[model samples]
Target: MKKQTLLVAVLAALSVQAGAAVPEKTADTVLKPQPGQTQAAVWASRVLTKLHYKSTPLDDAMSEKIFDRYFKSLDSEKMFFTQADIDQYAVVRTRLDDAITGENLSVPFAIFNLYQQRFNERIAYARELLKTKFDFSTDESYQYDREKVEWAKTDAEVKDLWRKRVKNEWLRLKLAGKDDKAIRETLDKRYDSYLSPSRKLTNEDVFQIFMNAYAMSIEPHTNYLGPRAAEAFDIAMRLSLEGIGCILQSRDDYTVVREVIVGSPAALSGKIKVGDKIVGVAKDDKTPMTEVLGWRLDDVVALIRGPKDSTVRLEIVPADAGPDGKHATIALVRQKISMEEQSAKKTILEVKDGNVKRRIGVISLPTFYQDFEARRKGDKDFKSATRDVARLLAELKKDKVDNVLVDLRNNGGGSLSEAVELTGLFIDKGPVVQQRNGENKVEIESDTNAGMAWDGPLGVLINRGSASASEIFAAAIQDYGRGIIIGEPSFGKGTVQTLFGLDRFSQNDKVHYGELKFTIAQFFRINGGTTQLRGVTPDIKLPTMADSDSYGESSYDNALPWTQIKPAVYIPAGEVKEIVPLLDKRHEARVSKDKDFQYLAEDIALVKKQRKENSISLNETVRRKERDTQEARSKLREARLLATPGADDPILVPDPKDALNKAIAAKPASGKTAPVPKVAGVKGALRSDDGLQGSERTLAAELEAEKAAKAAKDVLLNEAVHILADEVGLLKTDTRMALRVLPYAADTK
Candidate 1:
């Protein structure tokens, strides 16, 4: 009999949740692959080998890559498993492909069991070390970047590395002004929290992690999403979820409310607040409450979420209440919570062009969103990025704006159709983007709309975070000469990912086999060049902290190479290229004297210098001095910018929800809508675009740092506005001169 046939017979007697029976010698519950998972592994492997853009075979060579990737995913810092463990597992390194293909998952599960054991040992050792005192005066450094380092050869070597790691943690708290007692308590809680999350990982989670290691070995974008992750992905894409409307995070075996969304049930109830701990949950008022204090976050969330209008009761300990304090019961009816924050928003900037004041409309799109379910239900007013943008453009046109700018600084793309439809709003009709499959067959995606929304002066703002669909829209606008692309070069992720729910391929509807997201096609600009690694180069580049080589798609190993095909048949919408040289010249002159721009350049230089360091000093005095120096420099720069003439605070714009509500209320009984009220323009903060940081600063200090970062971004937006204003002026005065092409950078194609 075949291995798959034998495995099917064995799986027939195993339980879905518990999987195969564990041995009596095992102290803790050992996670094993279920029957559905083995089937999914086989199906996913077949799909990747046959349909993936890379079309890489699942052979011994690929299996070795998956083996390395799996270990990296499990313990990238090389602190958990030793070289001996790796050597012991070497027998199965090149056999993973055969095992997956044959529907045998014993090797991966056995490896994961050993990893779990090693993880527990390390955590226990860390907890024990927290009981001892460390000398912070020692002049030693901890190399946190261990990606290129070899694994420890022995247990003693790993333990010594842990000693240095614990010391580094202690030094950070000490520099943050924590007392020895507080440091011990905090470290103890943190170590326990780390162990809690890892120990709570289910078999499904491990399977997803291992499968992704297999998929991404072929390319960076290919991934496998477990059932839980798949739901979260859908929520992100749809920008809405049916829940109580609060964010939760795991902390020391407790599910704590991190934030209460402004318009969520939790926010309206006024009973739940940030930092509150959820202790128990009940299906409804009548059902018995189930204690969930130590349950995994995803499990707790699953219990809390229900169908719309259904009641889910939560027992909580308030933020101000101690863990031993009284617990309160709160009942909230689940409802659709629209993540309006992620939706498109608009502001009108009154920029100065010489002595004339020009009104410029700016629309900030965080993502290309679409309510897929609502659209599939044939709802005429379904929410979509294109629909919202079209409405915003109409309102901006009514405000008599001279030009409009679409801000896509950190948009990581969504809904390829939305990108095409959004591009259609600017031009009458044209091909937006092209997709080439593995078979070299190209499909052209275009906008067949007959009319334009606002054919005025246009500008597109992008950064290293702008990718995929964002690149497509920006590239189309640039290719059609419809707008001037601004900011840094975008993230060069030109691949298209198609998500396949694995359960669809199975006969059993009761089992959730998770989902697979794999790259199917490569996106090409209408101008013929692929945006794979080169991304969409801006017509006018601005000062950015993002470096193309280190930050974008090119940074990933085995990323698809840049290529080009024959350009799609299209006509130029309007000529903005010839005038780009004048805009660039003016932009340079203005920013040269701008204080905010100078400060931003200096900060970027400091960040680049910091990125070069591989380790941090464990000495408290040295670390504290370094932190103080950087903080002091940041403060001085902020003060200088604040002192600069005309450096006003950002204007406040009306909330998008409030504006929409007002518009609806003002509509006539006959159904004609009234004009949206004009509110002061506001600049969207770019703090998140800078990426995450591990700072030991106080909350107040961090807030101030964020404020300074936003002020710097205002300078970039201000410069883009000025450039658009200049474009409007040049076009109005002399069309012939504005249409004259000048010698500048070569076209992207």
Candidate 2:
């Protein structure tokens, strides 16, 4: 009682809103518990409170956090509820700890029920608003980023916000030349999609979301996946299947294309990109694309994905397109390939570094993936990143490429074992990364493989999206003085998480509990510093949006801190640090005058400027003028670049059939690409007695990889080549890292 009183006083000092208990009434009914949900939630809580790296105490303080998170999750934008709603739910806010442990599953379900009710009302309001005409001439603006604002005091206040929100969207569509009738239909469909999904949110779904709110409060990556989501995880891990091969995420009530997976139908079609919105889908070329703006993600995915050789047409709103802006129709042929995602691709780029035209080999590795099934089956020719990259390096040697750029941008890590093995390709066997488990025990992971793959003029290209095994690989290269690290700091995802199946702990076969991902270990770089939050900083920094703290591991409030322990026992392979200054100097001079690089800088600055905007003018004429001015400037820039043939790709409506051909045509003259050599598809390059037969040559695979690199138009990669070229000409091969080393905190045998 004394400890609880003291904790309440401490929370009061902190002035946390959720910690305060105000006078309130408990609702009559909360959600009914699923058969095994109570036990699963309790088990998940115990594991989190015990094993998580933060080890946050399970007390009133944590209860307050969980309450606040649940409320925020239910109504983040405050569009669905008013202050009265928050006050009414106050009784259950402080009772979550009891609910989780004692099987009183009422509070979470009750809150979700209220949220669903409010959301339904909002959807109805939106539909009505769409029916009415918006006078865009009114001099008004919508404050879009509502995250910093407080909840509306009344339903009337929220309705006004939603009205302006609907009006702003309508105004944009009007500016894009959409008529009232078409705009109404578009909005109707969008609202319908949003409302339609609410019906699908079963008690299990709501429970999962509420539970995740608690799990996420502990740490960002740690979470509880319900059965449905767990099955999706199973599919994603399989890596490849027949579909459009487009990665998607739900943003702003639309399915946004996160990535057009390389070598897939989406990439070959060339209509999809990072921020493009899939507003509609069609079954075939003859059918009109169905609008999918507010549609559930899985439903939208089901509509697009089909069997191999089948076609799905997509209606896409390009990233830069405004509301009602021109939409492109793309049709893609689905192709099924088994675990081709793990394959390493190589491309040689021809660039002028001073008077010399250097053939810079760019080896693009998407992830550290291995065919676990094949390896388990004792297949010697099992496709693995280490083997593929090693073979690609050998091909690079054959081509006599002047320098190498290992592009690791946007690569969410996969296999940790593969990271060590890949590092082994560069430096002769040594310690790679240290794993620190839950008990503070340390284990050294090393690359014991013999023979260096390629040691000359290596550069690793990374971005803020790079993480986990990517960090391990980059840190090893930097620490060993093996290569020059370039681009923004990587995503600091060094903590290790293992999924715990909840079914194992359930009382009986009444219901199948899901899985809990709990952080159990931390990864330390070979140099002793953990890449938990402060990721591997580059030796040569590049212009990037990730330079800001808005992205990557640093953005999470509970992310682990950067700490240095002790360096592993290993000799420096070679010193590339000695040449960084020279590389940096050359890089600076080049980017300052380089047209492509200047465009990247200008684009980044413009994005940053736009991110600072607090509101947008809702006045129709003013908004149209602003849009026109921006569009005009973009068009003029595109025209100038097109005239000179710069690699900066202007938005174009491409014929799906020509995209692959055009990509192939973009390859440099000395570059090569082909089917993954006879070696790639076969077990071992060949039998000891067999001779090379068939049309499968290594040249085409190298050439295809080259073509893909050209299609991507990577600025950082080009600069890496220039930097490497400078090193080759100016620095001695015997150079070594001159940075002083820090010792390990304790010995790990």
Candidate 3:
């Protein structure tokens, strides 16, 4: 992990959104309010019904008190808030409990109002603290210090921290090129956007933060799925959306790009790389831009992501620049991102050892995904990722691939059932994993039976993005010694979520309908090892992400501790130790001074340094200089790769006479045609951005249409065949990871 603390914070922020807002609703049995009943009580009754609360005989005062207590307890330190901050919230909390018991609107409304007010105050405090400084490196340290101090001491301490922090931040800002005037102006703009009435900060912001905190408190996996948040996630996973195809996050005041999907219009346009701060968004040059400083990341994303085929202009402060730097407006076109690009496809490399030929099979699984909607509709034709993988394996087997490499890098897991099924493809009948629910009950999911698809020398490649179900599959394979695990430690997401419907309890038109995602279970490896904060250990120790933001379980806030129940019996295929030295040697030889690897290493270091800083200048000139340096570096890297032989060579289509390639494309499912040929003399070879036919085809004349179609169909299979022919039955490297338990956490890689 780059900085363990920062990594943990970011992971917590990302993972805690799964199993949140566990709603505990009661049935609203109240028929109606009495004629002489107070308006507060009458209104409360109706509201309770609408909210799906089971109306009890209890009165208004009690309900208010209960709700108040729940809110305060969740934020006791006033880091969000504490009981001491208010004089009579204690009474209000009591009243809330009573209000929920009966249908009293007055007390319920009052409680709701109080909650909103306190929530607003909490948001204010959080914003202020962002601008302040602190010596505390961890949340625990901050909590401890907060608890020890009295009110007066706390106030003074906070003030002192702020002064010191602000001064340091200001210095960084100056270096980034912001003068005092620019700084003031920027701050004024931010204040207007964040605190203005039009923004709805007091209501919407508080709601969001409260939901986030609530999710974190329950369990790392549980989360409140706000409509907008859900929408954002869907767009991200689909790898397509309007506006820019960049993932953004809020760090204190600025909105930063966390990741950029490769080949997106933004990436293709040579504009707006990761870590860029989005200062403003506009529809066109004639339109006035909206400054987004100090806004929530979600809100900023909402503004950027819109309808498909639409364009949005962004004013960006590229990383490595100061204030008063040149801000460029980048235009981007939204296009559907092909999932195949992210998947593990095949490539053939020629390797000769004393006239011996070997073939290697590369299959990339980007997230263990199975489209739930398609499955639920009983659509047998629905895209089953496992099925595709199984077919790929079968084809590879025909190609006589000597070794198989399963790439799972950047795959944040999906579809639990798919994980088990995917794992089943490699092993015989056995327990896959154990799940422990809230009541401490356990259920073991087992593979019914298994026939190995293509069990040649296998290697599973993982990275930080490989999490949850992905971790489970990788861990199982590692434990069984079925394959070698390569790359980095898997993401620690051991929890399982269950959705609870809230619509069933609501009454009337107020629509208290929603879903509560709760962490109902924790996943355990068959060997009885927990993958909670400690993800699966890789077999080969790779030197990557050593200083990257990718974090293990321990990095997450309030993450569940790693523990074991009992190990499930599992048989080992082979010990990985026998090939450790050879794998190490190969990796060393392959990566040593390799330009691509070296560039990646340098990029990671620079990014780590950039993330650690808190403030930068608002000046234009300085910012432009920084942006230029980054752009130049990127262009240089691209040029270098192009200069390398075979590195930038376009993929070639398989020839009909290629036997090894033909073996890889024996069959194709209906409606799923074979890949097109990449050869120059092919139909549908070159097209516009939106008209990209396939990776297998090259732009050519229509006179060669028939030949081109056949050629294109064999491209994927041909590559697979070539890989298999060269690597199959050759020597294999096994040592993938060096696992050890450090004092802080388990090292998966």
Candidate 4:
């Protein structure tokens, strides 16, 4: 909130609450900025109005929108606030436009204060309800997802919801085999932390949070970063951290592990998993574990991060946990994650077309990474996504692969320059993408590089997680008809953000205002369609982990709408549009008869069906049976796949020298390490003409690492290979039909 609102002592002067039943805050408040956040907010507002690509006006229309978004962010599920509370907040809701320019944020701060008071009431009542046991015998259902539900009318209404919530949590703990005493202790520690909400917060924190609600109300990608958040942002750009090596975010009251970096302590530990909810954290073996249920994501991060070799025990609720399942605690050592292991990797898959076997190369890019410092120092070998992928493409060409698949699953995007340059490797020189600024000015980013690396049949594999630069490259390839897109729709993060450090705007350097990361540009494909929310649709769809309806850009309410301008003039190279139908037909037929694909379809069907359910059975018997049935089915499917030949496809392992393969080497059956075996002409764990790499790794460690990698591989990628093979089959059948031929394509021969 703006600094001019009030001082810490002002709480004593106010006896009346603004619009809610909240009384004067008896607890202490974080110090507001002495100068009020007016300077920062006004500055940000002015910049955004002039620079943000959306160029949306900040009138009372946006003001009310911001008000709604602020509360939605604080209480996303509509559980904490009532219609009366919202009614009370109506005044401030109309004053944001003036307040932002005038440097007045009293209303926003007031709303936040009321939110805190309501949260306290809800949590305290929940603690009391936890004191008694719940009657699971009664057929009661709780709607866990209340995002679209109506606000409760009275305290009684909310109290009933909290009771069910508390009961459900207790039942899960009891199912996990914890005693009543243990469950109560856990609940106690969790609830007690809730009484104090802003204890660790600074004025900057409040200002950032309030302003971010405003900014994000304009669009999903625009945000405000406090000083601490800005520092962390820079650290992430460096792609290294001294911590448990897992990315974390606050989801509801739980701290969720978002991504586990390979070669880091979390990934190497073999215990941590993505989507795991961390409830409590302990330092070393002796220190008492502290509950972090109500802690801010940054605070949880601070607790998890420490000096190398320090032990951090994490009490985790597995991602797959049901309402009546147990959680476990695991200990891991803190270490530095350098992100070297997250670089682009290469492997080869052998696909059979008719009676002949063809080798198809695959490149997996985790992110669009670049070593800016190294490049600035004139290091020719500086690591970068474009450079690395280019080198890998050359290697694939040397091995004479028939087709190439670019695996961009879960690649959330980076480095726009890399995205443009990467597209150059596939298509002839032309406009790659168009960028429109806040002023409605358009600039075309083109690939002037005349050289092409891979002009053969190509496919890109994407899912809801592929975004930003991933969308740019994929869109450009699709626009140019350079490749066929396979898999789910990409994440619709077409907006471009630029970080501005607030210190530059300040006259005083002693105290730093935070930073603003606002959207400066939006990406448009060569076909002139903006990728804003309607991300690049794939040529063919594959069964995904989650449907786009449940995830991706379309899920956000404030995302920019997709639109189109005049298409950039460029001749299409390939008949991908015509070929896609044939490939789709073959794919449908293959997956229908394939056992692995059948199991995949069945699993996906189950998940989608489960997603429609608002409530699950509270009875322990029913829940246990559900879990057991799922497990039994999974085991049976696994056994069947393992027994079938070609059902177990091995991933191409990246060379150890390039990427950090620090995962615990797979143990050999005899407890002995063997040199990489010569198989299928695969050398050093890379592809050659002979066969696929199997024994190229020290057998003991190679096997284990391959096993781990295989378990994580989805059936979609193997399907992508089959689709690519079909394209190759088309090309072989009609050799006279030239498809997107590179000017220098003969050089590969």
TM-score versus the correct structure, for each prediction: 0.86, 0.74, 0.55, 0.76
Estimate, for each residue in 521-555, the C-alpha lDDT of model 2 and write its tens digit: 88898888888887889999998765344578887
> How much is the lDDT of residue 715 in candidate 1?
66
lDDT of 3 by residue, 96-180 (tens): 4343344343443333355434444433553464454333222211122232223323444544443433343443345446666
Per-prediction count of colliding residue pairs? 0, 20, 77, 9
Query: Best lDDT goes to which candidate?
Result: 1
Clashes of 1: 0
Q: Give the candidates in order of TM-score, highest first.
A: 1, 4, 2, 3
Candidate 4 structure quality by residue, lDDT tens digits, 1-749: 11111121122111111111112223566334346377888888887777777787888999988888777766777767888899876767778899888887777777777776787778788788767877877777777767666888887787888888777777766765678898787777666654543343444545666788888888888887766667566554546667777867554457777666655677666677766789889977678888877565556676788888888998898776853458788988887667656778888887767677777899999988776666789988766888889999999888788889999998998788889989999877889999887677888999999868887778999998999999999998888777889998888888888888777888887756677788888878889897778787899998767566647888877778877777788876566777788889998998888877778888888877776786767776776576668657756665654443463342343455443333233222234432232222212221112211222222334434445446544468888988887787787775444333322345323
Question: lDDT of candidate 4 vs native?
Answer: 0.71
Candidate 2 scores a C-alpha RMSD against the true structure in Å of 13.6
Better candidate number, 3 or 4, judged by lDDT: 4
Candidate 4 — worst ten consecutive residues by lDDT sum? 12-21
Could you tell me the lDDT of residue 539 within candidate 2? 94
Off by over 4 Å in 1: 1-27, 131-138, 547-550, 637-713, 737-749
Q: Please, what is the whole-model Cα lDDT of each candidate in the order they appear?
A: 0.78, 0.69, 0.52, 0.71
